[model samples]
Target: MKVLVTGGSGFIATWIRHQLLARGHTVLVMDHQDRRGGLLDGEEFFLGDVRDATAVTEAAAHADGIIHLAAVLGTQETISNPRPSAETNIIGSLNVFEAATQYRIPTVYAGVGNHFMRLQGTGCYTITKSAAEDLARMYNAYRDGGQVAIVRPVNAYGPGQSVAAPYGTSKVRKVMPAFTCRALTGTPIEVYGDGTQVSDCVYVEDVARVFVAALEHTACHGAPAQPIEVGPATSCTVLDIARLVADTAAEMTGRAPVDITHLPMRPGEVPNAVVRADTSTLDVLGADHGADSFVPLADGIRNTVRYYAEHWLPGYQLQAA
Candidate 1:
């Protein structure tokens, strides 16, 4: 099978590309930016944007399947600039769906877990993603064309994730990287609103596997479009995640445990009391691997801390020098 992955340079998409290759599928990557490196022999790349239907259609001409992963994420960015978010997340998704419908090709839509359970106060990121998910369902139902599977992934974390702004212009503070960096530098790990909000953090490799499973699942074909939840079975509080990173970093760097300091929650950020992926749909699709096979949080944190310590921290030190 030949699979076309949008946003192939992204954190999760990179792993997904490797998984596709491992499965003996021809991989075609379509992205606006070329952050790809170390491509396997015979793999192909298409420089394009998902917002342009013509570009997507041309890029996906030889695809047996499409995995739509391109979108502008992050609550702060979306809230601050809703136009670009809507353009990329909604309009861009529409382009993919249209192309899939045109080519009669199966597509897997990358969705967010927050959109399914809670919508209010989650900001434009959730809003646009929810709209895109709905658009995918609409195309799946009425088009009478190809299959569309929606996978709502939980908070995915791992190595090679973008920890700061590209080119080091500013900070893009994600949970794991932020905590790990602070802990390594002997700085306080900032926790917002008492750190009681729970989130299901799934490893990137696990997520990539689930995506491939969802893309090829037979149960999704010819059925009413429904979302398959993919993530760890358990949920952990924000404070718990912070402390785990702190402990892991301390062990690796021989530094004292960092303090978890409470801070005011950001605007438009909803504190999720509980967040867990419902893998029942995955079970029906025979893709229930993520239910029991997710990496343990502590081990995942250790690996992530090591990645930052080796890859990101050294660069920062050299630049400072």
Candidate 2:
């Protein structure tokens, strides 16, 4: 099957494309940005934005399946400037859904974590994502031509995640990168609002596998995916993550143990928020999404730190030096 990955250059999308290629599936990449990630060969690339309906329709026409992942990410960034984010996340999703229906393509949606479990999320990104999820469900319920599956990934962190800029407009400030980068540079790791925010930090590889699995289920069974929910059984706080990154960096790079500084919580953040996905939901697809199957926080951190040391840290350090 030829799978069109909307956000082909993103961190998780890179892994997904590799997995698809490994499984002998043809990959079609469609993104506004050039292919900054993923394999260089064997990909039918389409340089386009998801916001354009015509672009999405043309791409979907050639795809047997679609994994919609293109969007403006980062909660705080979206909250600060919402018009563009809303346009991409909401309008972009609508275009994908419309295209799927038109072409009868089995589409997989990248949904958010358990952020909507407690309070109906209020942030611009959150609302837009939720609205998009609703569209997926609605389109599936109607079943005009195509079917859509949803994979709600929780706190995905790993290599290739961009480190946030202190001054410039960095798209996001991911914890894994921020902590690993600072620890490698022997700088104090900053935590937001006491670093007590609980998250189900799953490794990026595991999350990508989940996405691929759901897509396979939808494509093979020709049914809406079993609503896969992926997260860890144990929840790690923000401070816990910082400590893990710092400890791993110290062990791997022999960096002096860095301190964790608590900063005020950024806007659009909930300090008491917690996400523990019901991994059992994946049973419908016969995929092992059990709590123990996913990578542990400590092991994941070590891998992330090692990747940063080899792939990301040198350039950053050279710039700083």
Q: Whole-model Cα lDDT per candidate?
A: 0.81, 0.81
lDDT of each residue in 21-135, candidate 1, tens digit only = 8878889988898745756665788889888888998987889899899988887777777898899999999988888888888888899977844356577888998898889
What are the clashing pairs of model 2?
none
In candidate 1, where is summed lDDT lowest over 10 consecutive residues? 164-173
lDDT of 2 by residue, 43-90 (tens): 888989999999999999999899899988877777778888789988
Stretches off by above 4 angstroms in model 1 are 36-38, 165-171, 218-225
Q: Least accurate stretch of 10 residues (summed lDDT) in model 2? A: 114-123
lDDT of 1 at 255: 77
